[model samples]
Target: MYVGEMGIDRPRELPWQELVLGGTAVAVLLGLHLLPDSGGVDPVYELLSEYPLRSVVVGVPYTLALLSANTAVVLLGVAMVRQGLLRGWLTTTLLAVWCLSLLGLTVFLKDPVGSAGTWYGTAHKLCTVANFVSLPALCALLWRRFRTVSGWRGNARRVGVLAALSMVCAVPFAAAFLRYGGQLRATGTVLGLIERCIVVLDIATIVTLAAWSRAMAAARDKRRFDHEVI
Candidate 1:
């Protein structure tokens, strides 16, 4: 019997459109740091949110990049669900929370460094924490799911590694905030550097998952083609 006739679900390929969108978002985010209007803030000491407030040049692009990234993530999550990679409501909820937190980051910009926190700023901080917390949890879930599926163990290990790195990066990021009593001006800690590393790993994890789905789809097609030829 064919794979489908044997009650196996074929992997759902992530669309090229989603990959392009995600790639564009990553490019834009990385490119933003190169702009001349960055307000002279030290990247190692300060947070990325400080950039947008520094100038309109950075603000507009930063907002657009985040929105694009959020959209790409939502599309990817849906693809994973259809592919049976996200098998339960718990995983679905985690994906939703991560996406929503990303949206919140765009909507409620953090307060300027060393400034008093406003309501929106407080909300922004909450969302930042949520975003950091949720993505790694989702990666852990994906790792568990991928480990059991044939042809997916490599990706499972990759995702597990990314999740571990994310958690490790979060340590210093969190410590900097806690040391400052939840303030953003922890100059002694490499808060910006750690945050940047976490962001890169998070994006890399998403790309890895997308690559896994695409690879599975290709392998499934090849198996079907061979079965038909035989």
Candidate 2:
């Protein structure tokens, strides 16, 4: 079936791979918080980037998590293109930018909390902003595209919810950062918690889309087999 220029047929099934990649990302992210020597950083006010700046133990896992998450997103984007869930060069460009921004995170370490600004830190901040903005925008576009498709309506709803939740958390996160001029500790806000929530939701969105694509592909294959047998 075709919806405008988007094709929704014969989706490829690769949910397990995506799950493995995304799961690794989430697991490492969660594990960072439990590290005994995590800089004595306050999870409520400090950002996840603080861990690497404080402890070498956290840095390796943090880099691994970002790499894993980036791979998962790249795979998901390819699947979306194959399944016709994403259309147009504009969306494709956005996805590429998002993936590159994610990769930048791994390459450029964030500025240490309350440290003098450096060139790498500035680049990292730009990448962070681009990563944050692009994913939600992509999700919004996907939700609009998927809602009308027969097999994708449910996935559309799931994407919508995840995107909405991430955006909701982002408002307070941004507000606190701005209100304190990026001094989150002085703002006394749960910036870390809020950022964590957004990351979790974004990961969930990727997994949900992967699972939905797998299910739809399976259903399509079964129907084709049954027709051939008959």
The model with the greatest TM-score is 1
Error of 1 at 80 (Å): 1.3
TM-score of candidate 2 to 2 decimals: 0.81
Candidate 2 lDDT over 70-145, as tens digits, reads 8988988898677655679877887888899989878987766577777888787777677777777777888888
Candidate 1 residue-pair clash tally: 0
Separate clash counts for every candidate: 0, 0
Model 1 lDDT-worst window of ten: 1-10
Report how far off residue 101 is in candidate 2 (Å).
1.7
Model 2 Cα shift for residue 63 (angstroms): 1.1
lDDT of each: 0.77, 0.73
Instruction: Report how far off residue 167 is in candidate 2 (Å).
Output: 0.9
